[model samples]
Target: MSTATSSSDLIGLVLGTLRTERASTARFTLSAPWSLRSDGVEGLLIRVSLGEPYWIEADGAEPVLIQPGDIVLLPQGAPHIVRSARELAPLPFSGLLAQHMSGAHGDHPITFRHGGEGGHGAALTELFSLHLWMPQHRGQSLLSWLPPLIVLRAAEVATTRTLALATQALVDETLTQVPGWQLVTARMADLLLVHVLRAHLQSGAAQAQGWLAGIGDKAIGKALAQMHANPELPWSVASLSRVSHQSRSVFSERFVQRMGTTPMRYLADVRMGIASQQFEQGQADVARVAQDVGYASEKAFSRAFERWAGQTPSQYLKLRTNGAQIRRHKG
Candidate 1:
């Protein structure tokens, strides 16, 4: 499926390639002098602080203070600790998960209280968080461009009203639990995430050499979106440069500088990434996968796939299947 992308498009290609899956939602009510250390799961985490400000310290990163109405996206699932203050020692989140599992009777938000028992606490910090999962390949393309923590501050709400409104709607739906709320909140969560990402991209904060930078660039972003929109198309430097409204030489130089690779090489990587996703699904044969990804011949596709994946197509399939089987047996 090909899409004509423009320089003004935000996250069109990233959203097109990704499949978002909802996981769980929980509201944490904690008294002052509390902290929880959560190990990163294989997914994304969206946190919104409602009642009080808190400190979040992720591994290999500095601590950030989260204020009310602030939306934070842990795109890469980096392990982190959330505390009411900077000096508190954190308790493992597994303990809270275990408690919730033991007491869970329905599909309701998991609730936890810290620093005090029962319901009487003078100062309480309330935080609501939702978990989501995205396909690994596309997730990497998105997350690699993000910092370990992304905060959409409450101050930006005036100019970015849609974001503020989305956050409010998600919180309301999650809290009120109206009919069809599961589906409603799932979509709202998806929209909220997209807006958060778009805001980050437009903020000019992502300076690293990756797809994020490409998306922020005026000329290169359009070409990047087109390549991602149809990785299977036989794309050439000249064709992509035209889409970017630049000559071949200038576009090639800009793309290489921003993305750290030539346009053709980047297209090759996108094709391989799509092929890997298909292989993981196990729904297509080698020949069809090869052709669908723009290779005219299976041998040529196999050679390229191996160079990108360090394994032949068959080997890659077998390994993926074996990994699934092992996981099932373990379960």
Candidate 2:
């Protein structure tokens, strides 16, 4: 909710929000002192700052030059840093000061702050982080809308302090461990995400068709929201047409043209995404998940999931479990 959430914190929060969990702002950290590091989780990141500059490092792509109000998204999760632009690495993501940079770097964390040069100056270096553990379900259905990177300038968002404050509160309560902060943080983070995304859609960037972009459009976005909000609705052309206030033929055409797929196909994709999420969340019974996603039987769902996910539900869950274990082991 608060711009106080750093790139990692925002990702974590968004992840947590989608997971329907108590965690708000997801699993990450905020910095009191300045910082430069790779994200623990590979996802979206949002960073905003003034005065002291920062640098982000990712493989292949050139180093991103960051300034205050420069909202940057390192979508690929390439290792990077946020520091003075003057002292940048001309080659790739390597920075000079990284030579001496040392601390208890064990895991990735989200961050937010106000600061002077050198470090977060006088104000206790006020910083915040949101640690969100995304459930498998949250990743696919709702996550499809996100881009690799998104930067919303403070100048553009400054007018909406209420939303900003709400987000800040989400980060603060989550980071500071205030009473009832987790519950409150989740709600505020959701609202704040809606507002920030709305602002991005209005910007008219080419990549705006991303997650937030759809939300800003009246028809397409609304339709998408409906499908995502209820992926297992057993929706058909008639139902979708009725909901969107168009005739069957017209609705069918528009949905295909706009979403680039037929309503049924779109529904199938949504189901697959939800199915993948279930796998990550640790639901092993394929039949139950299939029914939950509107499939009448396991055979039909298996056919669909195999096509959409390239693996059966059972295989996919096994892969995810193995992957999570490997991550933990590597950690």
Candidate 3:
């Protein structure tokens, strides 16, 4: 395969493991003197404003003014309050949902009306929200690489026509509940997220050395592609440097500068991450996962896995199975 394709495939492989589930979309119609606060949420909460500006006060941060055509991503699901004015008394999001939403938007979004006593007030804010849940195993690491809050302004979105279109489509989709609208909106949401990430990477903000920065660097990007393309290969720094056509010192320095980790450490993380997923999914036994990830000795693999995962392979697998059972029972 071509080098570019391999790098893209590696990125896709990493992101594909993050499956979005239980996505619930909601639109809010709000008037002045209105506010809504959600307690700490466990999953992601994305909000886009399509109308008048509002104030969003997230925990541990100053209140942000979100203007029309602005999108906000709260990846950690931090508790936040959205208000027409900063001093408004906040209403609980749950209570607002109970009061206004009838839960009738099957496969679509539910509309919530806030701060209108008996539906008599003039509404001024139009906000759309999407609550997304990522897979447990890989999702944690994925989130660690991202900031707690990401806001894309109208001007930024305007830079990428595709992103603008996708964002606009989401706003349109929220307003009109047509047939198969859920699927279309979901696809658009995914597209918006991908484009946003790409735009962020292209910008210099994420250049502080991480996977995001590494992916944008040509030499490190090629080396990463090689490592991910064949995790089972017995890869050394020299070999990876050769892939990037750099000397050992040059490659190692550049890799660390871009990825914030050594080539060997990056390879180990990739292998272990893949192995954990395989084990969690019951796709492979302990020995198989170890071997597939390039570990020759099961004992050595178990030791390394323990150091990385905080438990031995067997223990981790058993705990995962029990957790799944508990979740199933709760469901």
- Give lDDT tens digits, candidate 2, residues 1-331: 1212233333333344354333434222223344444433433333333343355544434556544444444333335544334353333212422332232221222333222333434323222333333333323444455554555666566745444444544554554555666556545544445455556656665253443443444554545656666666777778777766778897777666555457777667667767776777788999999988888889999998888766777787788888778656864
Give all candidates' CA lDDT scores: 0.73, 0.51, 0.70
Instruction: Assess the local accuracy of residue 99 in candidate 1 as a C-alpha lDDT between 0 and 100.
Output: 84
Query: Per-candidate TM vs. native?
Result: 0.77, 0.59, 0.72
Worst 10 residues of 2 by lDDT: 100-109
Residue 199 error, candidate 3, Å: 2.4
Most accurate candidate by TM-score: 1
* Tens digit per residue, CA lDDT, model 3, 172-286: 6765766655556556556556655665665555647677778877788888887776788888999889888899999999988877678897787777777777876776477
**Which of the two, 1 or 3, has more lDDT?**
1
lDDT of 3: 0.70
**lDDT at residue 183 of model 3 (Cα atoms):** 55
Q: Which regions of candidate 1 are displaced past 4 Å?
A: 1-4, 7-10, 102-109, 116-121, 137-141, 159-186, 245-250, 260-262, 276-283, 302-331
Instruction: Look at candidate 3 and tell me the lDDT of residue 165.
Output: 41
Better of 1 and 2 by TM-score: 1
